[model samples]
Target: MKGINITSITLYSTVAFSSLFRSCAFQVVPTGCGGSRQPSTPSTSTGIGIGTGIEPAPTNSNTIHNNHVMSDDSFGSRRQLITSLVPSAIVTATGVSILLSPQLSFAEDVQVDPVIVDPVIVAPTGEIKKLFNEGRALEQQGNIQASQRIFAKVTKLAPRFIYGWAYLGNSQVALGSLDPAENSYTKAVNLCVESRKEEEKLGIPRCNDLYLLYLNRGSLRLNNGMAMAMAKEALLDLEAADSLRAKPDAVILQNLARAREVNGLYAASDRDYTVAISMTSNEVSPFWLRAALVKFQLGDTMGSFDLIRRVENRFSEAPEVRAALAAMLYAKGDQDIDTARKKFLEIPDRQRLKYRNDEFLLNTISWPPRMIDNIKALSDAVGDAGRVEI
Candidate 1:
């Protein structure tokens, strides 16, 4: 819509990328001073025409460095400004004053007004690139905790970096730290949006980063049970990226399906998931949940039961699946007290009470202690004669 062609592939790519790096704030620490100076304005890099020799402004020394000069409050390189202002008579005739201030000791409470320095844009060095690659590798290998730490360092080193925030959020999600992951995703989206806005203002090529950022944030919200907001956000992102040429990826489709499901749009959600499952090579739990939910909503109890069983067998370790199973068993038990009693008895002592009391079981081990004792005592008194199956 904004003259940037978007496709389904771009949509998925954007979504995936959104989940990876989401910031442009470069990480910098003062060499000797306690607080590192931050740029008041965001940075833009041409990567081609922009000069690379301009160093960052020296915070402590009150030194100002700019490749482009500033005019009328506009920040730019000196050369660019000089070229533009060279034609003006007043600009050429009038001399500007340059001021310098002495440095103060770190411990002393000096009242030196802080200087506002433009950001210094640096190319990603080999070492930083290596760290990023290593972090990605670790993430792929399922070392989420380690990968998250690496990404954190990347963001710290390159605060204005785009990929740094997204990946950090992904690592946090993998570690099951939803709150931090949300924060990271928020930062990523903010950066992506800002970057896109800057690019748009300059009439440059549109970055699909904003599209992906929204999609990833939506997915995170969906999984965390914030479905309504997630769905809305995902819709907005997908729409923005509608013009890209790339085909919609399986992951993006999956996210859309999930968002729809969370929003209670059953038919549409089911269709999306069905398509996603067909596209994906791996067996994902989401597809199972989608189908199971459809069957459940359609009153296909047996179908839902079978699906739940498979989910239990395959992903037994997943707490969500376990909870779902527990819920199903509890519901079934509620419908038929006799059958429920049998099912409850079938469960292990520790888990038996878990079936009876939905949600978190309170003191499972000591539960039914008195009832169990009474039954045992009565059985002992009656012996073989009182062996009743009730």
Candidate 2:
């Protein structure tokens, strides 16, 4: 991923439930994963990162122990969110995603380039290809159990075959075998890395995007039994591969940002959140910015000031924006109590009441944990900071 221009690659699955890949990204070939071809490199590495939603990246290969909690994943662990499945976020507040689920956001609909390895490497035997394709066919027909059986055999027979490993992981996921799926994906990623090292030795350039970024929304989800630290190492590695995407989705960026923030890579995370904020819908952007603001508040007060200044300029008097800023200011307590008071007063009573509604703030507003606490204090203020202030 070191400055190589990533050409386009289609998303597909030889596992199960990949109609989206057939429709949106590539036309699934009945014979193999044949589709529109882009000239990409030939190998990947074993870096794993946590990622959620869709697509993937080559992340670090830390063998995370199973006992660690979510925060234990490291500084801004890659927020690899497999949506509902992957345990996510550097902090669960503001919904920064983490970990690859079975259906993986990073590689949920992966369509591998047939020429995955350099010509020097021995490719899978014809018999293995036949079996792998057979598995793909069964998976396409929605017969996941049949596909899982075939793919498992394929991987066992051809352990070095990257596609075999990938397909095996995909099938395992469809069969609801998450731990086994992670193991399969891990092996595949290792092969990708090993292949890339060979390419480097041979002076060949390869783009291992398929393995590097295979965190599908389904596949990106963490097994509840796995340590959060191990998941974070994977997510961090996954985020490194995000560069290949043409129009990277906002959720991926935001989740990645949160992981970076947790890792204390403040500048990089700030940039990710800022860009993510721009790509998000107006209704949603403010809260994301609110999350960003708090993260900066904790790490860099100057950055928060810069961000709030931009928020005031761009959103102006938007209700959520005003409420967020007011909460932030009020959280500063005596430092900006007057400004917080004024900002709250500017809100229409109806809007103010909505912020007062804890349930609404929690469910709908998606407020960050720190800001949520601030909102509580602001709601319970008295005298100068109260509704009847001078």
Candidate 3:
């Protein structure tokens, strides 16, 4: 931002001061211009000489003389004139000083101090806090049934408490009570809406809690695979979660993208997947893999291949990356089979064991006979290497 020039700006004020004097009562007498001084008529009061020792004309005769005449009344008028001119003279001097000085500048360079407001501290009711803490402790300890009992009591005692309801919902989900969990999440969402105004005034952000509730419920609905209606409901919940979070989590975005894909929203799903991938810092992020899968499904084979190549370059030794790369190579047909076999054999048996039950990975890897034989040979080699080491 450019600053205003104080010196340039003061010039206008200097001009204004000059304008004030333009309508002055006094007129400037030109020096060395020969002219007779015109005489003025004298009033009944005593007269005072205003010029160079000029005698006052007598008022008794009705004669007009070529001499200037001014009355005592003019003294008061001159005093008023001086008083008015003094203020303007001072202002003009100040403006001129400012215009001429090098150090003086406008205060435009000074930055305004930011107002830092302290965060509002919200203290939950003692009984509710205690119950909530107990529930959390039990959940952390993996005692889901005990946690559910505590969270259930919390909801009964403080039905309006959003966190209580959220925790209760999570507990119910852990105990495989999907219906009760959905109901609890719904109740929490309603309370969050009702208390939104108070939350804003108190400088509290409860939207994240609402986001979690919706996301959990949506994920549960999707994973249940009961009906198409459930999938649509999951999409709605994920959308709500996306809107509430300040910066949407990559996991939530990936989930929403998958839900969109299931509902035949290929374009929207691709966009969400792209955003999710961009949000992630990890080169081998699951979102990247998921997006690659989406691209392949949409017949963007070249795009998918590029994404897989990126993962392979960054994590060449990772089993998941190698697995994905081999699958893509196999999709390209016989010309790439030798390269794919070499990549497939590089995946260690121990690494494959860790993801054996991963349904998504299992579905992703195109386990052809050659790939299976390669995996078996690699496992045998690993066993032989272990025996030789012993």
Candidate 4:
């Protein structure tokens, strides 16, 4: 297999580590590669930091409940924003790994059975055709900005060309210009709807572009934070996309689960997550981490533990996974503090601050007063020893 660009791999690895293990305090070894057709946007790498939400605890259970309400209101709003932003970041970071690692074929290794949607055939004449192919080549080469320009010209030359608009949106997404991408996809969808009427009159088959357009648009909207009024709009688009395709993609199911999770539909989200996991049959996916978090949030401690254990087993060298496993063990309330402490102390000094300041672990861990004091002392000692520069 061709080796991925080490620098790009490091950048993505850092982002994934920082975002997923913000509270876990583990350094991640960089892995994977970007897709050839995707834009290597700097913004995608820089925006992967997850916010911490720790606060002083109340003295009693009643006060704790009140604080939980207040905290939920505040955290819920902020989390909505994070949820919207993180999905696009994750997709950009992780989606290209299959392309990068030729040794691990998706069909054989991951067992991803993607829904086979019929391809859309578009024939453009003269300069339009020349420019359209050029744009596609540029995009395939990762020259997203250049591709965007060419697609813009194509759209201008042929306003009614649905594929032109859709490709334009694709380039815009790679460039991290999501709002413009949304507009381009919306245009393609509307045009597809109009063209479908004409095709029906002529007894032509349904245009497959509509499904692709809706799928892309729905993913953008779903990842951009469904807490806004646009969530329902995103859901509708996803459902439309799902219905148009003969079979549903696992990615679509995953996206739907995330959207449902954010909408407080835990049961439906759980079902979708289960289906997606079964489809992939790969335990090390970010989706598994997400499902684990959802399970933990829903008080399914054992389920969360099982998921974390699977990740830990697969990525044993991953410090983040070890840290997470330790935290989850502590949350289980029956684990020996000494064992958890050993795992905690195994993390490097440079990464100790993240665990020390982690809001979720602090709130969830059933630490005795002496254990808390000892952990704090250890963290302070590490801070005094000097921090490692990331």
Strongest candidate by TM-score:
4
Q: Of the candidates numbered 2 and 4, which has the greater TM-score value?
A: 4
TM-scores for candidates 1 onward, in order: 0.47, 0.42, 0.48, 0.56
Prediction RMSDs, each to the true structure: 18.6, 21.2, 40.4, 24.5
Point to the candidate with the largest lDDT. 4
**lDDT at residue 118 of model 2 (Cα atoms):** 28
Residue 218, candidate 4: C-alpha displacement in angstroms: 2.2
List where candidate 3 sits over 4 angstroms from the true fold: 1-124, 175-179, 197-208, 225-229, 246-249, 309-327, 337-390
Candidate 4 at residue 296, lDDT?
69
Stretches of model 1 off by over 4 angstroms after superposition: 1-131, 137-147, 200-206, 209-211, 225-248, 280-286, 299-390
lDDT (Cα, 0-100) at 9 in candidate 4: 13
Higher-TM-score candidate among 3 and 4? 4
| Worst window of 10 by summed lDDT in candidate 2 | 61-70
Local distance difference test, candidate 2: 0.46
- Candidate 2 lDDT tens digits, 1-390: 221111112223333221221111011121111121111222222221111101222221111111000111111223233433545435457786566444345434444333333232223436865675577566656666787788789777766565555556555544556577667767656655555545243323232544233433112332222323344664554475455444664545554554454344556767777776666544333324544454644656566766666656766766666766787788667869788878877877655766666555543443446677777677666232244321
**Root-mean-square deviation of candidate 1:** 18.6
Query: Candidate 1 versus the native: TM-score?
Result: 0.47
